[model samples]
Target chain A: MNWALTLWRLASFAVAAGLIALWQLIANLKLVSPVFLPGPDRAWAALMRGFSNGTLLDKTIGTLEHMFYGWLVASVVGIALGAMIGSSRAMRSYVAPSLEFLRPLPVSAIIPVAIALFGLTQGMALFVIAFGAIWPMLLATVHGFGAVEPRLYEVARSLHMSRLAVIFKIALPSASPDIISGMRLSLTVSLILAVVCEILAGLDGLGHWVLLSARAFRSADLFAGVILLGVIGYVTALAMSMIEQRLLRWRTSGH
Target chain B: MTSIALRKDIPSAELEKSQIAFSHVTLDLGGKTIIENVSLDVKPGEFLCIIGASGCGKTTALRLAAGLYQPTSGHVSFDGEPMRAPRRDVAIVFQDYGKALLPWRTAAGNVALALETIGMPKAQRPARIDELLKKVGLPNHAAKYPAEMSGGMQQRLQIARCLAQEPKALLMDEPFGALDAMTRQGLQDEVLSLLDASKATVIFVTHDLEEAIYLGDRVVGLLPHPGRIGIDLPINLPRPRDQLTTRENPEFLRLRRELFDFIKASEA
Candidate 1:
């Protein structure tokens, strides 16, 4: 690897270290009770302990399963809806009001309704998160697809390209960047929704773990869970965006 | 597939009868008329270039000829039959250097996409693709994607792809407009050579008046804003045009000046 890139990575680590040091110094100086404000070391130790027994791994996998499923379902449905909205003026005009109304309401805001319907189950959390995450994807898809060159569409028609060929080869790749961007933004929202549902409903996921630890004065475990969730969210976003970049190689077709 | 052994000697009269005709065509875009009562007649193998300013409806008229768009008034017909949609026998080369090309496909594969679109036999496509690539002077670039190639290379590939369809008539929308001077000169020669070799009638649209004069048997100029035929001039320039000789010729200068005067008047 180039030294510049290596240095950038090191710098990022250094920033994280500085933040941890500051937090630890503040807690130690009695800025907050040790019972409530755990040092980074204590959180790290709790993280290692949780991983050593696979309890953290199990809960992480559980949360991840819900997240991926919700993401997949929402992405598929959202893309379809968005394409339709983009292509047809009538659908866009008709569907605009309802989608606008539904999108602004927080995923957590729908938790009571989800619990009432699915009784605090994984389905309930997944539904809330997926529904929440879908708007960004739909909006992005509509905009991205709408923005594809009209000349390109006419070319497709003149070439007698089949509907499937046009969608897969033309529409999807063209719209992918915006779609992935929306999805990247959605992943964070999904995590927030998942955590909110887990904590408020006392469901068996990361947020539930954080709540349990914090309630029992296990501040280290609570911080550890929070940090793990952050890492998961960040890593997933990075990977998806990388895929977006690769597929959009054509967009950079210039010297 | 070339079956040289079994080819019968078809008469020129019979071939000339199968011509492309645009009959008093007027095109409308969003309630704004572009082509106003424009008529064109092309004999088989004729290279006709439509020259005009930007937004002069050169492209609109070409689209009508290609049957991509229907005339809001009058009609574009092929051998007396009104064009319903894109004809199976015609191919178009867009100016955006095949930005319309499916990105997933290789240069050969982009050509092959038309084959696939028409549901041609899978076995015949590769050989045809190779022949076309060779014809377009891009045999080695066949495996490359449009994104990988230079603008000129991409245009060559697109032309090669159009050739693979074995079109009876070619409609090109200023295919070299995006290229630099040297590359544009090279591709123009390639296009001329291809036209010389094939019997395909061509209706090329270009904003470049010199280009219109250089390649066309007849150059039709359209004026912008309710685009109508401003001038239609026939060129008697000899085949295998010598770049230096043709550009320096007094006759060529006279034709260009006349075209410029017409265009200037149109702009005014």
Candidate 2:
């Protein structure tokens, strides 16, 4: 079984390598203009040069910092609001309609309004990123806390637990699986929105680097920036899953 | 048997000394009556079993005694005082041990949840948690989560958690009904031993007539469709009941047969 799993993993890598090789062939045959689609070799060289000169490293850090801060802010606000709304029947009834209306409003659509408010600043990017990212976490928390096993509440009641005690000791832990899943989704949203905001606001991040390279007709540089963004997404997702595995160890390790 | 007459025959003086009392308690949910005009009194440290068909409101009756639900009419009380809300002195053990336990927490952590709710000092919790786990025969499995434990082990953990509350009464809703025969018998004896030490009043609800007779000092049967007491029979079996011997005793068998007949007739 272990060997079969290893073979399957190797097959996946082979597929990815095949796709890249196909792209290299297309570029070599000049099916796409060199200005639009650079060969993989040129992209690789650009990536190395950018890193050696430290420009790529600075931009990567900037993007990561922006994404992390927005995600953190969204997490705190989402959990607090979700607990308040989820625990109280009256609160849920009152707030649910408004949330339904606001949740689906696209964050990119509000970018113009945000730019008007914060004007090409990091604050604008943060606002846009947070607004886009908070929904998944908030909804997940509401779902988690709301779906807590009714028996656990009965247990809490029989123990004469205070309202606060129920929330902390029972509700929070009970809702954690949902909350963690929501955070993972929110982190992904934060990254996407962070890039969008940086590009639109002309902030100094990978998104801005890509946008500048495109405008300057530096196709290899643009491809390099896009590749780095993929790396960032991969690394962050890997890190988040590790954290999830640790936090929810009980679920995976037990029945 | 005239159950209502049996209730009436109980002296008012004895009623005052009752640990838990349901006086003409009628509960209605969603405009439908669940249990109507049910009256029963549990003596201090007595193990009372309530048995009935499905949807007969035995669990609902247990909930009223636990103060998780209030009766639509009449009163339910603990120690002569109206049970307005759940009190720290009463703990409940639910039948679905899988749902009853916090899956995220280990056995020790689940026990600690009860202690934490009662506001035990942080510095003193570990010792008490250890004692409670040991009491439930889960001393070595403290670090295991509920999912890691067998059904019997999970039920024992639930019992351990409830014991941590130091409750004077335990309201159980078919707590051992889901376990296999062997595990159920083991837990039945384990609970009896635990009660021997704590002397807590117990209101155990189940549909199993033999189980009722084996574990209860008195077994009360409920008639379905707006449940009401159908029979209230006292078990004269000896204490520290041996699973094989007590079950074999003629008196135990007679009481079990009587309860069985009551349930069958009520269902019909």
Candidate 3:
């Protein structure tokens, strides 16, 4: 379509390719061991091997499934709890201290406890990821619900809306933009947690794939796994942006 | 005492007054009184606009009348019953239209919201929504979300939505204040025309003196902190009044000037 944008994209790709070429040259000259700097071609072959053998793909799906479940659990629970706490002064005061205390405790810090309690099971992994992801989302949902225009609530009242009708029709939609923003933030955190859990907890995921390759000195596979995780992370984040665009299209154009 | 007297005088007036009311309406936000010793006698099929400076609690007065807030001292009765929460016979069009609508729904979906709120049958809502869309000149924009709309169009949809409740009265809080000049006047005319067609009792709140004068069958000026009636000015202009002539007319100009001087005097 637009030549300027097309050319810029092409140039950026070329620059990326050039950087890879330089890495290949350094590895070939023995400037660095292949253990640390496997060339792109070698990495490509390893990626093919993993894909052909189905190990990489399987781990990828496992990682995604964890991300999916973790994000879902966290988002749903966070939104509901956040709304409850945010709307009620009593609930907010009761829960605010605990949430503030726990939100800062790193996901890594909790893994040992999770492992000891749940013993490296899916439950442990899901809990760790969900725990971290839910915090930001819960706060967002609370704020979103709190920020709902009072006038709209009056609209519900004047229309003689049932309590459920007001919540579903007015309250949820009113607070959705802020809540979605929270979910977007939480999703990245969830993905990061999934990978960290896979690596430290010996779980079935891409993080484990990377760790295994590195220990065995399978340099190419290790590099491929890291690169694959990067792509997945980038795509996942972009997908969230697209979803927000579609969902809040009303807010965008309204007078 | 007066309420009982009025009710007995007119057999249908309670049903008429059940449309909306405010009496000795004292409102306390936290512990501070916002509206006090306020009273109004509104009939069905009439338009009343409240005008005042910011923080005057003119809006609060409407809220009290709508049963959005409980008066600290006086009682607000709707249709001869003590007002509680919001009623289905009255609908509000907010100053901030964006805040009123759901971001996920289309214009018609937003309009259909009120009907759904009142538990209208689902099977019949679509046709009602379509009728509203056509009435508001948004027949083709039913599926268009609020975000896709221009300010005037969004307000139009809001008006249509308020009407969908088939309310006996409409409550608006500076609904056109945020629009550009051209759009504001256009919406004002459109709103007036719609009110004329429906004969729906309307309680519109605005800070604009011109808008208050132009739209109201009577303009009630209010003062702040403890909101009280500053002036109760009536417009006796003939029906289906024109904007240009009415604005330039001697009676309209005199009332506008008197109200303008009244606010200035109050501030002084």
Candidate 4:
């Protein structure tokens, strides 16, 4: 099984590598302007230069900090509100329509309002990121809590569980899988919003760095910055998956 | 009388206590009647099974006994006190064991939930949990999650969790309905022996007439469309009943035939 999985992974990676190789070949053959698309070597050189100067790392760290703070706040508030709303039909009915209206508005559209309110500060970026991240987490948590088996509640009642105990011990754990999946989505959204906010607000982040490179006609540097963002996104998703696996070890493949 | 005396390990003073009773109980749900003017008396150490068709509301009656539901207008009491809510002294085993046991908890953890409810100290729970698991024939499955176990194993684990309560009354709602025939019979005997040893009052609800006769001290059949009692038959088969002998006994056969006819008529 391990061998088969390894072979499958290798095959999947080969396809991705083939795409990258084709992009590099196209750049080298000058099918696209070097200003529009640099070769892999030029991109690699640009990445190495940024690493040597330490500017890239600083911008990456700044962007990550904004994303993380916003994501954290969103997660805490989303779970609390979701649990409250999910556990009671009246609360859901009262709040659900407004939430639905606000949810469909894209995160980028909120940037102008945030900037008008908070200016080009970190606070503006944070607000945009948080506003974007909250929806998926909140929706997922609501769904998870709602889908809990009725029989489990009956069991909790039969055990004479206090309402608090029932919520904390039974409801929360049962809803965790959906909550984690939501968090994964929100985390990715938070990253996207952080970059967008940084670019729009002119904050010193990876997004700003990419904008600076593009203005100076440094296509290779711009590509390097985009690659770095991709790497960060991939790593964050991977970390979330590992945490989910560790926490939900009891969940079988059959489930 | 002889079997009752033999099963009574308690002091004579506590032997004949009335554990649970339902008096003129009428249950209405969503403005529609589910149970109407039904009465029952569950004596100490008795195994009473309620059997009926799909709409009979036998499970509703069991829920009332477990204090999960309240009668529209009547008394459902435990030890002479009106049952307002579920108490630690009464434990319920739901038919959907898959939903009843926490998927995240191991078998031992599920059993420990009862001990935790009783506020048993952490230090003493392991020994008690081991004993309960052993009683349910799940000594090797303490660390297994409910999803990892077979249907029969999960049901056994559910019973173990109930036993952890040291309950005076056990309410089961078609607990073995999902299992195969052999597994159902095996669990039926296991439950009998455990109840015999603990002397807990049991109210088992099932639609299977043979199961009603095999495990119950008295089998009560409920009629549908308001869910009232249609027949109450005392099962006089001897104690320590075997799958072969007791099922073949004339009394068991008579009750089975009577219940079969009653259920067929009710269904029609």
Candidate 5:
């Protein structure tokens, strides 16, 4: 009887499981053609086969590598530019209009430009991912830096702390929470851009595999790839949340 | 022993001279004059309080004393030299304690900011931090962050951080204004004992008339609309003043009545 409370905590996953069971029941009754819509068992079998044959592992690694490089480059450039622009009113005013003009251009729209510049290679994929991820990180960092309490600046100045020390200690730490949230947003964006670039370029990644399977009429393989991508997205987001919690333990650990 | 021997080499009369002096200082902010030709003298080891209404520019004057702002016309000096910028020897305690201390840093980490600015060796900081926290009656609260402490405790931590600088003069801008009555009285007595032991010159700004009389060797009443001194009264209340007894003293009552009348008339 006490297990009722425990089952309530697992309600989300239990609902997902129930939906999958219903899907299997409908497919078994042939309510729709299995050719167009296969049961969960077909997708699971395809997933297991792909993993055992090492194709899924290789493609996942390729996707992860592309995402990491692009995220890293974006983070470095975003943080540096954000700090400079946010700290100076003149710089912010000068660059803000140009950034605003370009920010609304969609990532899919930029694919042709990226393809022309770097071709269908890893470089092309990196360019696409970095281009897509940088905006959120840069805006978040600028806002974070701008929102620092003015009194903290006075405290540092009155103490006669050196210029570099003030920036590193007070400015950076004060802006970190906002900056971390921005990075989390950029992480999900990077995952999305990586897959999109992979599909557009026909490169070696989950996106390319999913596309190829769908074209060849292997619905189970396409479904399996989609499920794998979902898991990867969920796990990476979970990892980012862990890092954020660790960094912001000071805020949440006590009153 | 070395410092004592070194101190004896300088003339004691030079040490006893006015530590901070504002000579006809006028400050203009955004095309409007905020402080107009105000002159004041803070002698060595003196406790002077500036009491005024909200628009009287008392906080601006305190900032000037801290060398965080420079006068438009005359000179604000320390050790007879004009102050150009904030010096390590002059520390400031602000009223908004929540914004002043770093939220991410623990109480000890906040105090360590002053010590680090002075470039004390890393190995020597822990003991000095413990001593400073103990002095502020916050020995056990060292690991607690500013958000975790009450207003009074956070203010005490701020005071401890300022003390870490070992400044020759302190500029406090209504430090106890945010605390409750009992907490304010306790902190006032603690500040008196701390100043007594250190012999540091202090310029305490407050809107509270009784606080000005209770704490200051002299109370400078400022008139609003471009702040300037209106009444300069010496408080002859005895040392080691008690909260109940000092408030009940005749001279204290007299000074309070005078400052109260001055504030009322300045607003009118």
Candidate 6:
């Protein structure tokens, strides 16, 4: 089993390397115009130049701050509201229909409304990002809290736990697995919305960098921004999984 | 007939002395009658076992006593007060130990949940947690998660957590029903010994007739289809019962046979 897992991981790395090589070959053959598609070498050079001159670093930090703030707001509100709605049948019945109507509406469609409300600034981007990211977390929390083992509630009651105590000690911990997965989804949404908002609002982030580079016909710089965004997404996802592993260590350690 | 009349007259005074009492309790769930006009009284420190066929509301009765569920009519009282909600001094040991225990917590952590709920000082929790874990024979296994432990061990940890409540009354709903025979017997003895030290009033519910006879000072059998008591018997077996000798004892055998017949009849 261990050998099989190692083999699969190796195979995944090989596939990625193969794709990169294919991309480079296409560039060398001029299958697409250089203005349209830059080679990996050119993209790498652009990346190095941007980082060395501190341009990419600033943009990266800006994008990260936008994503982080948006995600944090979404998380706090999502979990709190979810706990309230999920733990009570009456609350669920009263609020779930309105949520359902709102949840399926495209988040991108709300960008104009956000822009109107906050005026094409960082606040507009933040609002759009949080709006897009909140759903997954909120729904996940509601589902998780609602699905707690009924026996545990009985145990809680038998122990004479208060409402707050039950929520914190029993419901919160029980719902954490669902909540964490939701946060992961919400985080991905946060990043995507952050970049979209930045691009549309003409803000100082990777999204704006990519947009400006394209307008200036600097294909290499545009490709560099795209590659950096990919890296950021990959790294953040990896970090989330690491945090998940730590928080849910008991689940995997022996069972 | 006169002696039977006298026996009926004795219950009024007995109800006053009882630690836990159910007076004509009826429970209806989702339009179906679950328990119908069931009345019972358990003396302080007495080990009372309730036995019946499946769907006989034995578990419902235990839940009522635990204050997990309220009767649709009549009342359940603990120490002369109406049981409106679960009391800290009444701890329940559920049948599904896996579900009853918090899977994310270590054995010691699960025990600490009870202490924390009751507002025990954080500074004093470790010693109390250690004492409770040790009491349930999980001294070395305190750091183990519930998932890491065996079924028997998890059940023991559940017991340990319940004991941490320092309960005056323990309500068990087929607690050892999921374990292997050997493990079940081991837990039964462990519980008996624990009760010997605590002298807590106990209400044990199970379908196992021999278990009822072996453990209880008295046994009540319930009839199904809107459950009510069928037969009530007092066990005359000696205390500190040995597994082998108690099974061999004539009185134990007789009570076991009586209970077996009662269950068979109730089922029919």
Docking class of 1: acceptable
Native-to-model Cα distance after best TM-score fit, residue A127 in candidate 4, in Å: 1.7
For all the models shown, what interface RMSD does each have? 2.6, 1.4, 2.6, 2.0, 1.4, 1.3
Each predicted complex: what DockQ?
0.31, 0.69, 0.54, 0.57, 0.65, 0.67
- For model 1, how does the per-residue alpha-carbon lDDT over A84-166 read when each residue is reduced to its tens digit? 88877899899999988988887667888888999978888778878988988999999988887676676677777877787
Worst 10 residues of 4 chain B by lDDT: B1-10
**TM-score of each predicted structure versus truth:** 0.88, 0.93, 0.87, 0.93, 0.93, 0.94
Per-residue CA lDDT of candidate 4, range A1-255, in tens? Answer: 999999999999999999889998999899999998999889989999998999888989988998899999899999999999998899999999999999999877888898899999998888888889999889988998899999988878778888778878888899999999999999999999888888888888899999999999999999999999999999999999999998888895243
Q: Candidate 5: misplaced stretches above 4 Å?
A: A1-8, B1-16
Candidate 4: which stretches are off by over 4 Å?
Answer: A1-4, B1-6, B10-17, B257-268
Candidate 5 colliding pairs:
none
Per-residue alpha-carbon lDDT of candidate 6 for residues A1-255, written as tens digits (9 for 90 to 100)? 999999999999999999989999999999999998998989999999999999999999999999999999999999999999999999999999999998999998999998889998999988888888999999999999989999898888888788998999999999999999999999999989989988999889999999999999999999999999999899999999999999998888775
When candidate 3 is compared with the true two-chain complex, its DockQ is: 0.54
True contacts kept of 6: 0.94
Model 3, residue pairs in steric clash: A250-B147, A253-B147, A254-B147, B18-B79
As a TM-score, model 5 comes out at 0.93
- Candidate 2, residue A73: Cα displacement in angstroms equals 1.6
Q: Report the lDDT tens digits of candidate 5 across residue range A134-251.
A: 9988998789889989998888888898877987788778888988888889988999998998898988989999899889888888988899889988998999999999888667
Per-residue CA lDDT of candidate 2, range A1-255, in tens? 999999999999999999999999999999999999999999999999999999999999999999999999999999999999999999999999999999999887889999999999989888888888899989988999889999888888787788998899889988999998999999999999888988888888999999999999999999999999999889999998999999998898765
The 10-residue segment with the lowest total lDDT in model 3 chain B: B1-10
Position A40, candidate 4: lDDT: 87
lDDT of each: 0.82, 0.89, 0.82, 0.89, 0.88, 0.90
Off by over 4 Å in 6: B1-16
Docking class of 6: medium
Please tell me which predicted candidate would have the highest TM-score against the true structure. Answer: 6
